[model samples]
Target chain A: MSARSWNLALGLVCVAFALLAVFVWIPHDVSSGVIVQERGQTNVGDAMAPTAWCYALGALGLLLVLTSWRSRPAAKSAVASGPRITAANVRFLALLIFMLVVSLVLMRYAGPVLVALLHALGANVTDYRSLRDAIPWKYLGFVIGGTTLVAGLLALIEGRIRTRQILLALIAVIVIALIVDLPFKHLPLPPNNEL
Target chain B: MTLSLYDYVSIGLQAVFTAHPAFHVLGVPISMAVVMLVAGLLTGLIVGAIPALSGPFAMAVALPILISTFGFSAAALLPTLAFLLGVMKAATLGGSVPAILFNTPGTPDAYLTTFDGYPMARNGQAGKALRVAQFACVSGDTMSDMVLITTAPFLAVFVERYMGFPEKGALIILSMAFIGAAVGASAIKGLISAVFGLFLASIGRGDDQTPRLTFGIPDLANGFSVTVAVVGVLILGEVYQAIEDLAHQHRSKTSPSPVVDRGDQKLHWHERLALMPIIGRSGLIGITVGALPGIGSTLAATLGYAIQKRRHKGAVPMGQGAPEGIAATEAASAAVSGANLIPVLSLGIPGNVAAVFILIAIDTIGGLNPGPSVFTLNQHELNPELVMVIGVFVIMMLGNAINWTLGSMLMRRLGVLQHIPPRIMMPLVLVITVAAIYLQEGKMTSIYFALGFGVIGYLMRKMQMSGLPFVIAYILADDLERLLRQGFSASGADPWFLFSSPLAVAFLLASVVVAFTMSRNPIGKTIIKNADPE
Candidate 1:
């Protein structure tokens, strides 16, 4: 892609975003007008700032498009390298998102699943919420989820996972938990507090 | 009741010395603030020595945890601020270790250090180069702090006495415009980033009864967490980029060769004396550049090194094992740590990423506000904010003192830390950041928000957009809006309130001029091109 095309694409995107904000989002979302009068006092409303910014953004976008359109292309040797979003970047992002989703799922559900398993085994167990601050329960989800995320990312970068990497990930999670949990007695680890 | 100047100083000293004692060491009582300062300095050194980690990254991760430990009380403010100041100071000094020992720079500003430092290391003068850097860094930082202490109060008072709402609003517009224009490759894109940040910042509850731009989502009513968004963009965005870089390197089966250390790592007294003049000139340049918003230390280091190189009469060339070169770059880069706070203290405008975090800490901790009001010396009443500012000054001095004594020793020992693979460190950073946010907000939503912002940060980086403007704009958006509204109301509901005063109009015109000039040829792009013509 050339610089001209890059600017054109960026301009179009910005203009689209600005138009949507001005015409659709602001109208549907903001309850107040650009100027509001209440109790016989007139004041700038919440919509005014957002509306101004949107119009400015739109104008700038149009300016960018016009400039890119009017400007001549640089000589071959002087042409600057344009920004590229490669297929590898998409792949990496997709894998990262997948890892994050899996880790979050484990973080949110690991303790509850454990409690349910114990209950089904005829052992007395309370809900995860009640035992969020208790021993073992608080550490379970964070440790499992955190380790998975860390190790998964490591594997993604290294192209393979090893036992040493898993061990390192687990140790890192436990150490982080201790650092966060021990210093402040009232603060609960993640997902546990959510529960 | 009104307190004397002496009384305010005494109160400030007491805040740092006697407020909360963590323990006693050899019949001397150690305050929690002191302990945390030392802890933060050590952590900063370690973080800064690592190639992929930085001071801002450490500050971002440590902020929520520090807040949680200290809680939101007047007493908590000093200790939290102290730790952050410590990190800010030490990290700059520590970043030079990798630059000197290996060819890798731990932070962007340290890239200049490597030009002379790596050559020195390869030539068996690594120890001496480190010593010069350490000395130069500590000296420069202390000098910058002295300037901040002397000038900030007067600047703040001036701003307080003269600037009204209209002027203040115009100043913010000028700041955003200047930042947008100066920071990145394209001024239009940078301004767009700033405006977008403001737009995002507007998506929560305001003074009005109805939440603005929430789209009726319950979660959006409170708006995005500033901490989450900031960390996501600045730290995690970098992490994502690093991970991708590492992945690419892995596929290419290319790895950086390890550097071996074998050098006369010692600086004599005469050598230190010789480098002082260079250090002074560079420190002044750093202080000047850092006082301006959005022009960061990279420009400072480049100007410092270039000027010194032109004036070089040393046995070794400036770029090849010249002690003067190391001293000049290190001094200028380190000096920026303190001088950048000048704007934050006087105008309540953050000039850089570190200042942004400092402002966030003050806002989150909620006892102190950095602005002209902070310097208001009430004749008959005790101004606690003034005392806090003094206390901060005390912390900065302490940080510099520690850097002088122990920083050089730590820098030498940290050469091994440069070997930590980004592939491993980045993942752990991601997890730790997530956990930190979760611990602070105790909500899954905040984590999700942080991740979302992290993606934005990553994309922005790929597109060559500077995140500093976006983050600063986000932080300042509320203040800008408030000032605008106040100005309008004060002007009898006139829509042209921002243009009412000559000073305000001048500021607006300057902003437009800066935007147009810088858009045509951005200083950052020009400096980088000059520094590395390849």
Candidate 2:
């Protein structure tokens, strides 16, 4: 697809995904309503209050983008005169995309080591200079070794005394949260102890 | 209404010593004011120096935390104001690292710095440029802080008498026009961005529970956060450029080396003394522009750079690694950091985005109602003038002290980043950014928001749009809207009343003149010939 089409398609897909997450995915879960109500009361949501002007502005922004996009000439070829896509740029981009994806994935599941490995592999594949040097063992070892050392150091540091204090602080936060939640949670159906 | 300087000093001392223990701890007490200013500055430097972390997001996250901890006192208020001021000064100086070393601007205000700073880096003048910036920033910031302290109370009185809603509204409108005219390569684009910002500000809920434009979703009851919108558009927009970069190849092997000389580049006595004159002129530029509503440090810095560049035309070009360039830009931007506080403290009107978030800290924790009456009386029976004077003195001195000792040490470390590959650095930057967001709110969502905004910010940069003005506009949007609405309501919806105040009218006229004068673009050509008198 053309770059313009690709950008439009990707942007629309992102918007659609956000909408789906907000509406369908959120409402499907039985606990989502409770979460929403609780969140609505939070300071973050309080600041996120909806206004009529957002929609108006969003529409205007859309119009402006479309107008600007239309008035501009079709995309000038981004592919340089040398090659369609250089190996170096590909490596850089691969590494960038790998980091982004791994970060989001790490937030949910795997630890830093696994994420770092994936990033290294991505970097390796995209960074290879010539076809013959695509998987240079020495370079691969360097990327993997360097990434592991950094990740291990971080994990170790996070296990230290300072980390323990931070965890304690987190626990205190949770306790306070539960204490605050208790009255609100039990307010609707309390007084009788049900077995 | 008239508070003497002695009243201010005595009251400040009383509040610091006697008001409450929360305002102090032992003799070297950690009052809310002290905490606020110090924290703001520290956070500003940390966040701004980072590749992805930005000033607005950093400030937004810190304000709530400071409020919860300090619980509003005059003693607390000064510290928070100082924090923001220090942060502005530090961030402006800090952005030079990425700009010079990586050709990437860490902060929006540093974009122009990249133009000259990166070139200098190629020529191995990174250390020199950084040193020049540091000296300039300290000088400008000190002067601006003085201006704020000396003039805020008087300005408050004048504002109380002359500035009703209509005048305030007119001023905001005029500011929007001025910023739109001043920033970016294209005025049309700037205007479009501003209009978009104003439209975004008007979103969410209107007064009196009227739904202006929210769709069916209950979450839409409050409009999308301007922070979200801006982050999405500016940061995320910039991130898109990276994606585009991915589709191509980078040929950076021939890029400039990073072996800069750490030689005897120290400023001489004569050189140090020479800065006094440049500092004064640049300080004036910063304070004057900072006092205006929308124009901020970035523009002030640009004006300073442009003016300084005029002085050394034939002998040395500015964008080609002129020390004067670094000196003027740093001083003016830093100075504005201090001067911007004047309006915020005196009139309760935040001069920029960072200042607006600061208002939340002042109201929630400092227990001070900002604006003209702050100079008269407060709910706490505290002397407003006293708190202000002392706060300015402490913050300004502390800011300078911190810069002199600690700021340089930190900057030296950042200068080393030039050697690291962008491939390694970019990912690490992203990782650190996520950690910072998580630390700020302990929420995964803020990280997501930050990532999303980073992309937008990147795109905005690529489009050659001035993200600073738009961000400033977004921050000021609500205040401007409220003033405009209030002005209409109070004046029976008569548009003519908007220009009723003579001073406001005169200011608006002057704004027009400035806009016209700057729009001509005559200086770019004449600056060279003027420099080469022969």
lDDT of 2 by residue, B1-534 (tens): 565656666767555434444454457656544555556666666666776556765565444334334445555566555665666667766776677666777676666677667776667666766666678777888888788877987988887887787677666656665665566543434444565455545444455343434444554456555545544454444444443442343434574455465455566767667766776788898888788654667677677877887875434587886666667777777777667778777766565666656654564554566677666744446556546657556656777877766776677577544444333333233333343333333444545555555554554453444564565566667776667555655665455665878877876786566444544667522321111000
After superposition on all C-alphas, the RMSD of every candidate to the true structure, in Å, is 2.4, 13.1
DockQ of 1: 0.74
Model 2, C-alpha of A73: deviation from truth (Å): 8.7
Clashing residue pairs, candidate 1?
A: B1-B380, B1-B381, B2-B380, B2-B381, B127-B265, B127-B266, B128-B265, B128-B266
The best candidate in terms of DockQ: 1
Per-structure clash totals for the candidates: 8, 54
**Predicted structure 1: lDDT:** 0.85
C-alpha lDDT of residue A7 in model 1: 77
Q: Which ten residues in a row have the lowest lDDT in candidate 2 chain B?
A: B525-534
How big is the RMSD of model 1?
A: 2.4
Which 10 consecutive positions of candidate 1 chain B have the poorest summed lDDT? B525-534
Candidate 1 on B100-123: residue-level lDDT in tens? 888789878889999999898887
